[model samples]
Target: MAAREYGQYCGLTQALELVGERWALLIVRDLLVGPRRYGELAAGLPRIPTNILAARLKELQAAGIIRRAPRSRIVIYELTPYGHELEPVVLALGAWGFKAMGDPRDEQIITPDSMTMALRTAFRPEVAVTLPATAYGARFGPAELVVRVDGSTLDVTRGDGPVDVAFAAGPDIRRIISGELAPDRAIATGVVEVLRGRGELLDRFASTFHLAA
Candidate 1:
């Protein structure tokens, strides 16, 4: 079946013609964190039907939005060079909608990729440039993320590695990032833990991000 068309010549309409499909932007969002295997993408978005996922993948590929490559003998979906340019667009969209996100419902699943993406949206380059460079370990229950902070940049990746600080991140961390909770109070409540020596970095890190307000 042919996809629907806006029948308009505007650039926005044309761009939307490629990514306006349901779940398309989300597939792009998941890939923004990094490449993902089909199974991993499926796991991240369990609600998307298998048939729909396949169709979206094919559509994205044709639109030059994403490409598949083999690594370690397994194929993974990754963004093309042109597709990588969508980062700012996605980040801006996330920030624009951030202030409206009060809380998640019980059934809403917040995947690790989504959380990392939130970090990307909240990152303040001016604030981060003032902090020291270090790799910190972030564990949310069983999932772990390597969050590295460098001059004017913050990168979040999925893995376990040598880190200067390690901690179990919870709502308190989110509250701190959202500026709803103070760093001292978060620590006092035992919601944010400092497993390493550089505990001060956590405070600096928390200060570097906030919901778009």
Candidate 2:
């Protein structure tokens, strides 16, 4: 075999060289949701060593996959527009992985911000119903989200108010919507509990927000 030139490969190989590590993808995944401070990133991915994460961030920045912005005096990491294009690819891979691995019994957990973002992006407006009469709160991780389906829009938040339905689950929204956990089973197992609203309302909301075949 002839000698290989490290820099002569195509751009894809070059890109992989920077982000093909085990934790690098997860780093990108976190950034896909939104910009995060170093401490937030570290907490989100508890398995990654701090030094390695710092190194990967540096490398990704060098590769033009991410950029650092000052949230104050502190720097927060955010994906470039180029990096945002990878969202669909990452989501598809996650869907495939979920199907292949089968659903786990363990309770999944996600942040309120992440849940709201997921709903906003994945929601199909055509499937939505105008339910001005109902309001609800969903809890994920430390954040409590209040979802109000009024007229044609869906409003979600992390505060308290009058809500018709509340989804208090520990699992990530991605896993829950992908059918990794049966919503009823999650409630039955005590992994999630609803503070208000009838079962029909939850079913209607789920029908509208869940990923379709």
Candidate 3:
């Protein structure tokens, strides 16, 4: 059970009581990337206090949203089947919140899990199916990802790979994702830097992965 409860009998109330505490859903978000050790989760969410992380883990385990499994003499946290069902919900929530994300605060930092979910949220498979298969090696500050789109499928992973375009950007990449800035303009204004590969492929990237703000 969660540390705090709403004392109501509604479904939404029940759901909130289960995972509504601060940093709870964020823990879920990181676990969606894959199983992670306790330290890994802490590292991904650097700002979360250690005690809060421990309590949230216990609460989630009690609700069957997550489970601990022993691996190589260590314990790791992974989402349960019921927890995996939150994928669509989290993605939708992320998309909704993205509309209000104008800029990153000075202290805010991007993590691999968050970036992976962002790519998944912005991917337009219907539009991608009509274009040539492409890949992008993207570096947003210290976070890096290889975004691959084939037909209507998309795969994003941490690290660089053979890609049509390899570009770097800061949080302003949201401008391109929101279609608020054209790719050429983004490049011209120094909002994005082409590290390697043809710069024109950025146009393809902008088309394949976008979310209307």
Local distance difference test, per candidate?
0.82, 0.68, 0.93
Better of 1 and 3 by TM-score: 3
Candidate with best TM-score: 3
Error of 1 at 99 (Å): 0.9
Q: How close is candidate 2 to the true structure, as a TM-score?
A: 0.71
lDDT of 1 at 11: 85
What TM-score would every model get versus the actual structure?
0.88, 0.71, 0.97
On residues 1-213, what C-alpha lDDT tens digit does candidate 3 reach at each position?
766778889999998998899999999999998999999999999999999999999999999999999999999999999999999989999999999998889888888889988988999999999999998999998999999999999998889889988999988999999999999999999999999999999999999889988
lDDT of 2 by residue, 86-122 (tens): 7776666554554454443565446554566566655
Residue 105 accuracy (lDDT) in model 1: 58
Report the Cα lDDT for residue 194, model 2: 74
Q: In model 1, where do residues sit more than 4 Å from their true spots?
A: 195-198
Stretches of candidate 2 off by over 4 Å are 1-15, 105-122, 129-136, 141-143, 146-162, 172-191
Clashes of 2: 6
Clashing pairs in 2: 108-170, 108-171, 109-170, 109-171, 135-163, 135-164
User: Model 2 scores what on Cα lDDT?
Assistant: 0.68
Considering TM-score, where higher is better, how would the candidates rank from best to worst? 3, 1, 2
TM-score of 1: 0.88
